[model samples]
Target: MKRLVRLATLAACLFATGTVALAQPAAAAPKTLRYSFPIAETGFDPVPISDLYSLTVVAGIFEAPLEFAFLARPVRMRPNTAAAMPEVSADFRTFTFRIKPGIYFAADPAFKGKRRELVAADYVYSVKRHYDPRGKAGRLYRLESAKILGLSELRARALKERKPFDYDAPVEGLRTLDRYTFQVKLAEPSPRFLYVFADGSLTGAVAREVVEFYGDRIGEHPVGTGPFKLGAWKRSSSIVLERNPGYREVLYDEEAPAGDERLQAVVREFKGRRLPLVDRVQISIIEEPQPRWLSFLNEEQDVAENVPAEFANVAFPNNELAPNLAKRGILMLRYPRSDVAYSYFAMENPVVGGYEPHKVALRRAIALAVDVEREIRLVRGGQAVPAQSIVGPESWGFDAAYKSEMGDYDPARAKALLDMHGYVDRDGDGWREQPDGSPLLLEYSTQPDQQSRKLTELWKKNMDAIGIRIVFKAAKWPEQLKASRAGKLMMWGVGWSAEQPDGDTFLAVGYGPNKGQSNHARFDMQAFNALYEKQAALPDGPERQAAMDAAKKLMIAYMPYKVHVHRIWTDLAQPWVSGYSRNIFVREFWKYVDIDREALARRGS
Candidate 1:
């Protein structure tokens, strides 16, 4: 009887333990969002010199002076802190912005515990910073300040007189008429001027004190009038953004067309019910593609911006989520690409004098003989789309019909073309030569990555069947960029991506004056330049569209670069996230997003 009593006591203890375990509430999941990128940022500050990598990462933590949003089915432009949108003159040369009455920055130790309100003078100061010849602000060079009144002259004078690039000159271009109102004058009427202001480039406002304090290293320790402040930046690790308490919730004009109905509905559903959705956004640097994919699958990462081409198909379902993710995948989204690639004959330049005329002919014949479709399918593995026009599909004027007839894969025709060009083995040596008896050998430059290695091997096989002997030289990204920029490539590969939605970004790179900046092909033409210049001059509507189309047609005729693939970026993230879109490349989720943990649970339910 005593043993039975002990056994009962043991059973009672086990029941009590199980009840406690079941009764205890589940631990609340920490309110954290984790994101990943393929590359590491050089710094937390985004300056043009640091390249686009750091700039994109930094742009998130720092806020620009103006912001863009969709209203009534079109993109609407608004100032970050203002009662209403700015008023612009009919010609779009002069813009007047009125600062709101009570908005101010949150108290930071750096600001000496004072909440500094933004003013019109701050805008003037920021624009002038770009004009500074110190080359401190890279985006300023992109602004084409020449379009702005006297601002261009100041930049030119700074260059010629050996004075620092100064926007302090009393010019017609920019002025603070009063504390609230500021005016910007332009050289010519630009219909897209408002859009430019809306863009992050001109909109980011900074305090003059902060600007003077940091001076050269401002890109590293940026101070801006945005909703979030840069908390910490540890290189090759992560960047953090802390929400500013002084941040005013943004509201748009109900009557505005850019106020999207669908987005409004979503916002209304979450209003007041689940406020301040996301507490923090932690963007982690994950360089390896496989690790990033694994992190996304494991739910450790809230968003994987760039899904590897190989894993995208396996991980994403063929549903709205996948399609939405695909649309959002375009990171650092730019519309005009600055780089292009093409096969060049070294014989054209005497520096590569070793390549005989017959060998050159054989190479050119091989260009027409190779099958681009097979190359795209077998090598690219359906991740990229074939290219016919020098312009990528993301560009404004790319037409698909231009690729109809570039000649198919026919080894017989390749040999015949070579034979017709007088390339033959006259001495019974295995290698063919020109009529003048030079060896028909070619050298191709490429990188040492998996895709490149496979593509190069396939190209060699194709060339071999047509009696052409090719050599492959593997170089790093830097070496490849330099060689291509110098026009030293015989036949090589490169990729082009854009940042803004304009044709000029693609065509302007190859233009005569700016050739060094982007035109890797070294291709030049007066007529093409004229068309492109005219297109850039037009406003961003149908008229501009027509001009761009003509320019793209001419570009397609030249075939400066063969398009290998066009990718619609595919990204994956949890459903709790909101306010993220595919149209623009923005990393800060706190600025635009409001998450609902309960809603996410409901979604799963």
Candidate 2:
């Protein structure tokens, strides 16, 4: 697909004169923050595709089943969004939740723009959509809905046979007590039910009116009760959003006892606070990093993300960005990336036969040979920090102590492991060979971007010294992703943004169900799967923690992939935007923000 670079260029021109201003006092005009990124959002549908660009636009206006405030913020799992939380019945098979009243979807002209209250039927409708055979909502199926009473039977008949599901049927165990109340009779208790609600894709409650209104066009015109409303979406160029007045935050008083940190954070951000501050937010698609930085530097854009490495040394130039901006010390919010950028060695269809092996020695040899920290410092220009695990330290269940056993530089140990496994270069050809004499010359695929290429080249230099020949293969983003999923890759560079704050999102891809869908390396671990199942059945806290730790440790032990680096995203905001906070993923940028009136005045000045 051709990127709409001109749309961003035109939008850049649109705000060039800076004529558009938020309605505010002449003394200090509120700032309109213009954020730009290289990737273009494909659509507003939250069903899961790599591009998170459009999700940001949609999330701004729509509330899902769960909410997150990036890193360090507690995750909120709504009762309306979840079937139950905290407690599981003694029978360990049923969970129930009572919904709160007064919550409503965004007002659209179709609904007369008046807030429409949400109901239990809405959630039932949303969950059923995922079970639809025709619905390509892969992320939704990641949750083991079969554990929910009637869901198991429906899943057994409709899903097992791969047939279309009739969502309107009367399921045996699913029932609604009232308009705002619902209960699910689980086949067994799932302590991690709260995690499912917060999975965004799993828990996002959609209005029945929305499903019926657009029918199939709901992806284009989604309606949710989020802080913002979709305004104008000029495909490939820019997507705009306006504040939703119907939205209210759950406020917290100092008197409130210790509860869910995720719940508390949401209440703190929105409760009693008038959001948006700015009338509209414009997201520009600027694929080339150089041009994005140029626009921000020229004051053509209010905020810029993923600032190119070239500008790292110069982002703060003696207050040159906006003059008085230096006096404010440039508010920089740093948080660990929910997504870890890593390199994977695909064993090819031949190495692992028809399936990839979950071997410790083989993966350890690969991990030991690679020097991750050095690669990050040199190739990434010190923009990234080493990542030992796929899940960052900030993620709810991630274990810092589980950083892969393949510690700092050790070429001798790497070679020793291979030699012990009978992988040796007997011919002195500078490449290791199997017992059959086939050379271990693997092709490494990566995006054509400069940084990725450099990282790949670094891998080549390090691995080649250990008698492993790695040839670099370059492909565009879409091509690379397609090939990776198809298992047509021998090795590749890949990254993931946490769909929520847990290991469940990362673990879902590699299991049998997701196989080719997301598990690019095509590795299947039985121990990991068992742990995931156990974690799901147990309630949140220590029991679930122990199970998750086992799974995480197993993942690291196998070394299915090498963690190159975790990152702290940087967004350059033109001194005007006030409540702008960094999100764990770039797509969450819309959630918490308030344009600065003073910044707008300075732009005018």
Candidate 3:
């Protein structure tokens, strides 16, 4: 009786103190979405990185000042961390934005448990980081053209002194009007200046405390105000991201263009729903296509971004989901990506690069000899369209009616042009030599992979037909990128996806200042550079379109790049994945994705 009274007294005391509550069953398990990438992400730091794969991961962990609407057709920009769109003045040379109040950064050791509210000064600091000499931002030239007031002067001063960049230094171009408001002043009218903010790298906010705290390790420690936070990362193997517990309540919303039934249905299904429905996202890096495809077939991954060409027929025959996969409730999403794949000729190389008629003719002949149609059909499984120019579909200044000799597939014309340029099979060895009887050998840089091997075989066959001697230099993607940027590669195969809907993004790659950066070809032409500058200053209209076309024509005339095809990517998602769609401009789609846990359990997935 005494023991029972003691227990009763303990329970009574616990209840009186409000420590005891009714027993309840455990909550359901958190939902998770699994995906894969063909290549390992380089790092999370946005400033020094240019690869899309790394930026895709960064886009989720970081929030840009402006973002593309999740489902908006004709892609429109929307304010993200910013309270609203910036106010433009001074003939489009000045832009002012206000940071939203009460926005908090993800918890980090740098904050020391105190809330780190985002401010306008953070953005100013972030933009200045791009200009730092040590950063080596691949897209810094995009801002260089804008001539941001006093920013170049600061960069020059830092370079001259060979000192660490002064992050606290103020510039007239990037000024904090108040704690919440910031203004940008450009030397000239920049119609596309907003795109600089819309870009994932340029507009991502990096807190000063976080950067200073992490120092050289900033890439591994990314703290932002996005919906997801970096959880675990094993280099070249796997990465995991968990939901941000302190994320602000935001809903899925978009303004869809009329006459798009598919987008309309998607908007209806997910409109007004709270975002970041998935609890965690796990991404596995599977470089080889075969293993990546096998993982998808085994149901280990929820989504397969790029289906291997070998399994194209097995997964989607006649452009429809295979019967077995359809019965299993697997769906395929197909669309023309806003991108272009091409081979660039380094203008500094001795053999392939020059302004002389012979060198230009050699590039033009090779361009004409390439059978992009066959590449699309055999290599890509008819999942691409032959590109007419550098600018792909969905970008302003991409003219479907535009015609150029560089994109044509005419082996007869190729041989004739080669012969006219004095390139002939000297000594009857079946390989063309330089006009001066010098050994003419072209080196092509390619990744050592199944797809690249097949593409190289095609290239060899085409060159053989035109009597040109070609050799393949195989390197990994990252190595090839480094070599190309250093002007070491003679020719290389690469592609570019639009960072924005503007054609200026593509044109900037050929600009003189972007050499050793995006202009891997090192293509510096006065006429093209003049036209590019004119187009950057104009709005989207006939004048800008004309300049864009003229620039494309000049590139074709010089043949710095042999444009190939615009890929039509087909993405597959398991039934358990919900609210998933490919956004043309946005890479961070995890926040909008949800997992059907009950459905996954029922299917044993």
**Root-mean-square deviation of each candidate, in angstroms?**
8.5, 10.5, 3.1
- Off-target runs (Cα >4 Å) in candidate 3 are 1-24, 255-269
**CA lDDT, every prediction?**
0.58, 0.63, 0.87
Best-to-worst TM-score order: 3, 2, 1
Clashing pairs in model 3, backbone N/Cα/C closer than 3 A = none
> What C-alpha root-mean-square deviation, in Å, does candidate 1 show against the real structure?
8.5
Candidate 2: tens digits of C-alpha lDDT, residues 1-605: 13578888778877864655643337633235577756666566555444455545655655545544343335444432333343446766665556567777877655766668877777667666665655555454454433666664676688677776777787756667788666667766654555555534445667766766776677778777766677777776777776666776533221112564533554465556555456567778776667888887677777777666556556634223434445543454334667777666563456522222323565677787788778756665556777766666556677666555644568898888888877788898777886467766767787666667667778888878788776788876656766776678877777766766666666655454555555666666677778867776665688888887777677677766776677656566655655555646335455455665655656645
lDDT of 3 at 234: 99
Q: Which ten residues in a row have the lowest lDDT in candidate 3?
A: 17-26
Best by lDDT: 3
Evaluate model 2: give its lDDT.
0.63
Best by TM-score: 3
lDDT of 3 by residue, 7-94 (tens): 9999999886664344554687878889898877778887877888888888887777898887776688889988999899959999
Per-residue lDDT tens digits for candidate 1, residues 202-237, read 445667677566766666676665555667777667
TM per model? 0.72, 0.79, 0.94
